[model samples]
Target chain A: MDTAILIDIVKSGLVLGALYALMATGLSLVWTTLGIFNFAHGAFIALGAYLAWQFSSADAWGLPMVPAILLSCAVMFAIGALLHFLLVKPFERRQDIVLISVITTLAGAVILENGLQLIWGARSKQIPPLAEGAVEFGALSLRNSELILMGLVLAILLCVGLFLRYSRPGRSMRAVAQNQDAAALLGLNVPLYFSMVFGIAALTAGLAGVFVGTIRFMSPSMGSEPLMKALIVVIFGGVARFSSPIYAALIIGQIEAFSVYFVGLYWAPAVLFFTMIVVLLIKPEGLFGKYQRTL
Target chain B: MSDLILDVRGLSGGYDTTQIFSDISLQIAEGESIGIFGPNGHGKTTFLKTLSGLIDPWSGDIFFCGQRMNREGERGSRKMRNFNYGAVTRRRIDPKAVARAGLIHVQQGNLLFPELTVDETLSIASTAARGRKGWTLAEVRELFPRLGERGSHKIRFLSGGERQMVSMAAGLMAAPKLLILDEPTLGLSPKVRQELCDAILSVRRLGLPVVLIDQDVAFLEQIIDTLYLFDHGRFSGRMGKEEMPDHQTLMDMLFGEAH
Candidate 1:
């Protein structure tokens, strides 16, 4: 266990944690507020990565790197809103809503995945890093992209945390999450908040997609890995508590990074799932979550 | 007609396919106070819910502030998750629409969002005030000084009585043209009930209409301009302020109808 190797592992863990936090926060929000997992979340990430590639490349928009990513995020937001209203809202009225949402959103994921393949081709696409140079401190080294990704994730989380705390709509969203009937009595538009939550969730997932695409190659199926990690983070973080997912994401990210470091890459999933089982057995609610209202 | 803030005609509503009450009707003139007293499971709360637009009448009409409050026709095919069978039919006005129209319902048992701070609960109503003449959060605090003291505390952390006070304060913050309370004293101690009765008395003095439901006739008698005996989902008797009968007589009319 060299000091430099440990620092390198910690650096990679933090970067992975930052990416997981972005995706998991969105997953946590949609689940807590809507009580439905946006299974299309993974598809949204793939869409975002492909969109970012198209926008940044020379043949397409040839846009600057930052604007390209931002544009991709905006598009994902629109897609999320559309998916919610068109595909999800109708089924929400049915009995067995959880089942319906699962079926429909999984179908939506298929459509989005194939849609990406049709548009962007099945080949993996790479996005250039927003910054090109790495910085070294003593024996520790960090890639410029990883540093930027971590910073951006922290900045987004901070803004979202503040928004949910101080802004009126943000407060109303919390009120709805806490109690929809009471919120309606106070004249809060529940459906409007639903759309906003979905939009923002998709936006964050898309941003994560773009950041990951910058670091690694993206394919139509790339979203599956991130989506799996995001779900684990959300469950580990607790569903309703906003801050839980961030911590959960970081822990899961570090575990995956270090497990890969110690064991082989193949053992990462087994180790990760096993750790989650242990955590769930002890705190079924979440590592950071409080006892939620049961019915 | 405009002076009648709430006018229900031949209203019948209940859990789907089972009518709780039928052919029921009532009216509240501007600034009027009405009390409904009945035993539990006798539809007192159901009637209040219907008036607040939380439930739809099986077959009836409701008019609030000269606007038809029961959304009877063309609700635009919005599927309702709350309704039985998750149907797309429209029977009740959207509760938000009803609240916007100034008929606010404070549901039973201080059902505030448990996680929100008292400040946030009141702020929801204040932000959605929509220019209806009602108390601002500052004014609500002035009305219920205890709320001012506990403004920063979460509703879940409050005492039962404090939660009730927060509920009432939140209702007032919405600036309702009319307020409906369902069993505000349901679980309170006698002392807390008295305090709540006093608060209701003061709230009535603020020149707003109120419709109160409680099982306690003595408490209802304290604040109501008129009292209605409710039993088995129907209003069996009505008494003006001067004509309020003794507790035994009122009890007879209520439970007497129960069996």
Candidate 2:
């Protein structure tokens, strides 16, 4: 590839990595803490994207993008809590909760897709970029939209990391993730924690949706791509460590970007999948996950 | 002096449809230590669980501090029933109610949070016991001096003995009037077991009533003032501290002549 093309690939990789990290961090948190691999996570992202698209237009509401993003996140949080209570909590004690969550989330994904089609119609929708400019540095040109997405992802990740590290409820969630029975004995309400954690996960997915929707077209099926990418990133990063998703996302993004330029568009996903399989076979615990007693 | 701390009359409960124990009645007074001795699969743990509100007895009444305990439908119930074969049934009694009633149950195995430092665990325990004037973290650290040194270490990094001490300290932080210990020394080394026994006796010295449940007669003999021998879901015999028999008989009762 030419130097300009290489620079473009590198920039694309960083942008993709940031969005992937944002999407997968919540999955990792839920997996490590609640032991539930929420397949509907992508659906939440799609919902956020569609909401933002609806709000971006200067209709009677005329809501700004930042406020629209926050509103979408808040709505997603409530939806997340509802999902936890209705779908997750009832099956909490089941030994097959992992499998059940997959099926449940798959059902949720289908429902969300169809529901979006019914309400918003099947046509693709777009949200205008938060800003209308591009930054050029040497051979590389970065869209304002990409920078805004990166900024939003970083800000959300920092807030979430701080919350999990410092807040009392956040500490309790960590404690439960490490040892649930102990958390309960300490009078930490396990169900409440589950709901709160799921809500946070949904919030992250929602913000990511807005970023992704602004950059690309929003549709019912938009969740599938990022959902797959997030799952791959989370598995590659190891579920136990908090920073695993970031590293995994970076690696995957760079490889995807490079493969797209060197090989073909269809070949990039194949390379990503091959990398995931190799990592799983070589180190089943993912790159950063620790082997510990799970709940 | 005649007040009853816990009273169970005709209490019966089991897993699924299979009844493990029935018509079991027991009572404990203030500041009295009772040791529960039973053979394997005799429902000793089940009984403790039923009392803690972790499980629902099939038929019985549980009264604590003169209040009838509705184990069937109460929120955050305390009945703790663990099953090896099937689903474990656990009902958490409201921590507030448990504190008000001065009851704390330290379950088997290492129940400490693996990610939390020993000090954080104790601090959380102290905070949970804020409604009640219970033991402080400093006093708990004093009780288990090893805990003092390992305050910053996570429970996962601690030795089995150290973990047990942390669990005990967390339980005692509630300063419960009635402390229930279910197999407190299951996986401990001999030295650690001895330390745990010493800790129990020391806690008893502070005039806190305790319910120590174990299959080992020798350990119970050291700290228990009274013994309730359980056999096949029934209380087979009751022995006072002075009336306890030799090791051979207790061993025979526990394992049934090894054949």
Candidate 3:
């Protein structure tokens, strides 16, 4: 009931929502562009976390946090592209593509989780905070890490928005998302765009993974929790509408954060899930979208 | 050895084992204007789609600019669909590859990306322009001044005729050696259709080859040098622009015979 406590919850909610927004944006982009649900997205986040942990750990190279996150992101980008060409591409044109992709990506998620376990073991890992200390005023204190996290999320989302709007490949990706056949007719390389989008989506997820890992513990199962939250964010925001996921993430993040203040930690996921279902029942297109079936 | 820009030999294709058309063969000279007309569901669109690499022929070859795009070294040795064998098949070329080779199909029903602004739509094609020497985005804007006026507006808000203009402009921006217009005049007002037809006539005057599919034989007659009469997925008859039959007589041949 304390004002400072409420502000802290709101602050934490914003940070959590930022990570969710980053992860959800990629999921939404991949879904809209490639018409695949990409269940393996969580695995990319997990992979990023493990990579970041490995890079930043003193036992290993122990590189700085920024470089470590960047390295993990690059690797995840390649993984996303490879997954598209190897796994997603062949099934895309089939009538049952959605079902097939879900199954394949779920299997991919299993592979990634187990692979991380094999490499890093089942124990949790965490990176030291990039920035220490907090900014406080009027009984409300915000950690410097929270500021960085918020800045990173906003900056990445803004860059992505500009890319999709002004850049050639970005415009082409939008065209493909609108209509693949039309895009191909324009001599735009659909496969290349698909690969790029998948790579970018993975990169975002990877970045989110590192951000989450730096702030919290990195477990093999850490991605699944955020992945579920991202899915809820995307569904509640709207599939394919880029900005919708971020708005949805913020709202859900606040809900999950403040629900702890009111109801406790266990009730957050249930509350978010129920909210998404109710929104879908009423609008079916989420908070921002024209009714569309991306997959 | 021939002046043909596109040569199709016994082309047959449709959605997964269902043959929409069979043994369809056609040829087009460079800078020629060809029109195909048929009642709905008779595979006029399929023919255009087949040539543009949107669909693979069940059994046949497609030669663009004298290059066999649909078949490889051992002709007829490979099965396109592999019905008898257990292996899946690859299309001879992808749609984008075909477009790069200068076979651009501006599809019917105003299939522009609804979210893309006119300028963005034009830029996507112009940026990806093959070396086929057609209109650039700037030139396209000049050519379709209406599009230039609504340059930054999303295409979904455009009128039916305006959307058609945007579609044609996009195809032109891609710099196609052969432009395929699939039902370009579908669902347009008479005046708008005339305006579109006039623009298409000007395009033909620019000496670019065009293959058009539309039921409005009168409108097609403006730009088409030759016309193919399609019935039940086969070319039943053919005539030049000068020899085009009267509206009632052509209708009888196209629809009355089916009845």
* A200 Cα displacement, candidate 2 (Å): 1.1
| Model 3 clashing residue pairs (backbone) | none
Highest lDDT, which number? Answer: 3
Deviation of model 2 at B113, angstroms: 2.4
Ranking by DockQ: 3, 1, 2
As for candidate 1, its clashing pairs are B134-B175
- Interface RMSD against the true structure, candidate 3: 3.2
CA RMSD of each candidate after superposition:
2.8, 4.5, 2.7
How would you order the candidates by TM-score, starting with the best?
A: 3, 1, 2
TM-score of 1: 0.94
Each candidate: what lDDT?
Answer: 0.82, 0.78, 0.84
Displacement of residue B143 (Cα, Å) in model 2 is: 1.8
DockQ of each: 0.52, 0.28, 0.57
Candidate with more favorable, higher TM-score: 2 or 3: 3
* Stretches of model 3 off by over 4 angstroms after superposition: A293-295, B71-88, B130-132, B255-259
Question: Each model's TM-score, in the order given?
Answer: 0.94, 0.87, 0.94
**True interface contacts reproduced, per candidate:** 0.59, 0.20, 0.70
